[model samples]
Target: MVQHFNFFYDESEHSRKINHSTIVSENYYDNFITTIVGWQTADEKIVLKKYLDFEEKYSDRKSDGELKSTTLKKRQFKNGFASLNRDNIEFILDLFSIFDDNVLLYFSITSKIEYIINQLFLNYKNNIWEDMDMMRYSIVKAIVMYQPEEIISGMYENTGELVQLLKTFFNKRINVNKTNPKLKEHETLAFTQILILLDDINVKFDINWNYDIAFHGFKKYLIEKDISKYSLFLDREGDDGNTLKAAKQVGLTFVTEVDSKEITGIRMADMLVGIISKLLKSLHEELRYDSIEDGLNKKILGEGWFNLNEQQLFLYKQLTHIICEVNNAWYKSFCGIYSDDFIILVSLLNYISSFDTVNEIKAVDKKMHGEHFNAYVCKELESYFGRMESKLPIDPIPGGKKDYFYNQRGAKVFFNSSKQPLLKINEGCNIFNVLSVGFSNDGNAMITISENKNFLCYRLPKELFEWAMTCVAFANRGDNVFPSKVQFTKNGDRYYADVL
Candidate 1:
C-alpha cells in the first residue's frame, strides 16, 4: 500500500485589474503569493499540537482558535515583525519551526500584468518558446521595459492589435531616434521581437491566465515531490474553483475543501501565506535583494537599516532561515517565482536565501530554455540592422521639411529613400547566398557580401541582434517589405526571403 502525505494550501491576494506601469511585481497588490504547507500522516499529531498549543495561549485574546497573520493590528505591521507582541511572535516562530526536513513549505508568486504578457505572447500555436528560447525571455523583458503600455492595452483589446500598436510605437520610436536619438537598447529589441512574433492568431487574454502560473507551480510540486502520493486540504478561501482543479491536475488521489478556520493544518497554511505575502510586499517596496553572501537581515543591517526595529531584524532572520531551508528540496518543491518577475525573483531568491544557494538553483536562467533559440539568426539580425549601437551619431541628422506643416503631416516622418547605403536579403538567380550591403543595383555604393544559409548578415552580438533587426526592418520599411517566417529543414537551407 502506498502511504500518503497531507498538504494544506492557502493564498493571499485578490483578483484585480493588472497595473501596467509597475516594473517590480511584488510592489503591487494585483499579484498573489500562494503557499503550501505539507507533512506525512505519521507526523499529523506533531503538526496539530503546534497550532493547538498556540491557540491555547491566545485563547483569551481571540478564542477564535485560529491564528491569522493579521493577528497584529494593521497599523502595527508598519514596524515590521516588531509590531507583533512577544507572545504572538513566538507563536509565528513556533509555526515556522515545523517547516523542517519532514514538514514542507513552498511559495509561488504571480503578477497580473506579467500573466497577460505571457498569455498574449505564448499563445498555443506560434509559441516562440517551443524549441529555441534563447532570446524569448530576454525578449519579453525588453518589451516590458520599452512598450509596457502597448502590450498592456492589447490584453484589454484584440491580441492582434498588440502587433499594430507595437508597430506604430516602434515606427514612431525609430523616427524619433533619427532626430533626438534616445531610444534604449531594449526598445529596439522589443521592436524586433514584436515583428518576429506578429501572427494572425486572435488569441484573447483571459483573466484566468493570472492564476495559471501559480497553479502550475502548485501542480508541478504535487506531481514531482519525492514521487510521493498525497491528499490536499485547501483553505476555504482558496476554493475559487481553480485551486482545487489546479491541484487535481497533479493526480492527487485525495483533495478536499475545508475551512481554514476549522482545520489546524490549513490555518497554519493561511498564517504562513499571510506572513509571506506581507514579507514579499514589504521587501520589494523597501529593498532590492542583490547580495549573494548575506541574509536579508544582515544585508539590511549592513545597508544602514535605520528604518527597522530590533525585533524586525530578529524575526526576518528567523523566517528567512526557515524559507531557505525549503530550498534544499526546491527541485521537487519549485518554491520560487513563476511569473513576470521570474528573472528578478529567482535572482532575488537566490539572493534572498540566507544560506548557500549553490544547491538551490542549478540553471535558473535556462529553466524554460528550449532548443528553439537560433543563434545564427539572432546574430545576423543584429549585425545587419544594429543602427547607432555605438556612440550617438549626430552628423547629417535629417532636418525638418522646408515645406509648411499645413501642406503635409509632420514633415512626412520617414524618408522613402536612403541617403546611407542600405542592405537587403539577396534573392537572386546568380548571386546565391550573399547579403547585398550598401548602394543599389545601379551599384553606386552597393557591395555583395557572403552570407550564411542559417544566420543573417554575418553574426551580430546577441544583445545587439534584436536592436539591429528593428533598425533594418524600419530602415527598409519604405520598401513595404518585411521578412516573414524563415523556416528551413527537409530540403536544404532556404535563406532570407521577404513577404508582401
Candidate 2:
C-alpha cells in the first residue's frame, strides 16, 4: 500500500532582533528553527482526542487558540503547566504519548542572522518586523528548488538590481578583467559565479515563499529520501502562485492550508518547533560558557537556573516518546556559516548522542601491511569529525600570481624577457607538437637576442626534443639555466643557430 501521511511544517525563531553592528560579546541569542511533524492519515481521529483531552484538563484556552511556546510562556499557562495534573515535564510527556508509534519529526536549527549574512545578502527594510525572515527563507528555498536557469527565468526582473547590488558591494568597476585594471581575481570569480547563477531562463513566473531554509533543508531531505509524496498541510501562512510553484518544485504532490486551531498536529508542530528553538538556545548558551570542561554536558548537568537538568532530561524523554529515541528523529543545520565552539553538538537536539555515528570496520588481508587498512577507509570518519568548514574565506591572502604580468589580471607570467623571430620548418620536414612551456608567453622569453616580438619553433630530433623537455622542466623548477644559442651537427657539419 502507498501509505498516505499528513505532514505539518512550521518554523520558530528568536523574538529579539539584533543587527551585525549591535552585537555585544555578552548578549547571545540568535537561532532559527524549522520543524516538520508527520503521521498516518488514519490516525487523525485519535490525535484530535488526545489534544482535546490535554486542553480540557489543563487549559481553559480553546483548541483553536495558538499554542505557541511564546504564548505558553505566559504566567497562566506556565503556572498551569507546573500544576499537579500537568507540570512542564508531564505536559510534554502527555503530548508525546498521544502519537507515539504513529508520528515522525524532523527539524533544522541555526542562527538566522548568521545564515542571512553569509548565504544570502541581507536586505535592509525600514521595519525590523517586516517579513524579512520569510523573504530570506524563500530565497534559499528558491536556490535549492530550481537550478540557476529556472531561477533566472522565474525572477528575471530582479536580476538587474541583484547585479547592481553585487557590484556596489564588491566595488568593481566592470565585470571583465581586460577592461578593468584593478579588479581582484577572487572578486572576478565571485562575479562570474553570480552571472552564471543568473543566466538563461525563457519562462517567467513569480513565487511568494513564506518559509525559507528551514523548510528548504526539510523538503530537500524528503526529496532525497524518496519520501516526498505526502500531503503537506501547513498552518495557513498565505497563498500565492509562488507557493504552488515552490511546492511543485520540491515534488510535493498535495498542499493543504490547515487551520492551526483545527489540526492538533499542526498546532503540535508549532509548539514543538518553539520548544526546540528554546532548547537550542539553552544548548548554544551552554556551548558558549568559556570555562566549562565537558562542553555539552554543563547544561544537561544543570550548573545554572532552576530545573535546567529537568528541562534537558524532559526534552530527550519526550523526543524518545515520540520517535522511540532522540537520535532517530532526522536533524540537519542549513545555516551557511556554523559556529565552531561545539563542533559536534548542533544536531537540533542538545544531547551528545545526536552527533553522527560512524562504523569503523577493520578487515585484515593476507597481503596487507601496516598502512593497508588505513588506506582502505582513508580516515574518512576522522576527517569528518575533526573540523567544520566555514562559509567565509578562512585567512585569504590577496593579490594572486595571475596578475603579475604588466601589473594587470591575466594568466600568470612564467617567463618574461623578449621573443625572437619565428623559426620556419624546413621543406619536407613535418611539424609535430606544440609545447606550451613559457614563463611569459606574452611574446617574451627569458633568454633572447635583440628583443624581437616573435618566438621560434626549432625542428629538433627525438633525442634533442627530450633534452629540451628536461631543460624546460628544470627551468620551471627554478634552476638558473638559460640557453644563449643552439648548434646542431648535421652530416658531420656544424649548423649554428642564434635566438634572432
Highest lDDT among the candidates is held by which one? 1
Question: lDDT per residue, candidate 1, 302-379, as tens digits?
Answer: 222222244444555566666665544433233221233322223333332332332322333332211111232234
TM-score of each: 0.54, 0.44
Best by TM-score: 1
Q: How accurate is candidate 1 locally (lDDT)?
A: 0.48
Candidate 2 local lDDT, 1-500, one digit each (tens): 55577788777753333333223333334555667777667877676778778766657443445455554442222211222223666666666666566566776656543443333343232122332333333334223221233223323345435434433432332233435434334334544444443343222222322334445665655543346357887666655544344555665668776677777777778877765555545444533433212221212212222112334345454553443353242333344333321122232222322322211111222233223322322344235323221111122112223432321222223332322223333433322223223323342322222124333332243334445555555543334244344433333322322221
Each prediction's Cα lDDT score? 0.48, 0.42
Which 10 successive residues of model 1 have the least lDDT summed? 404-413
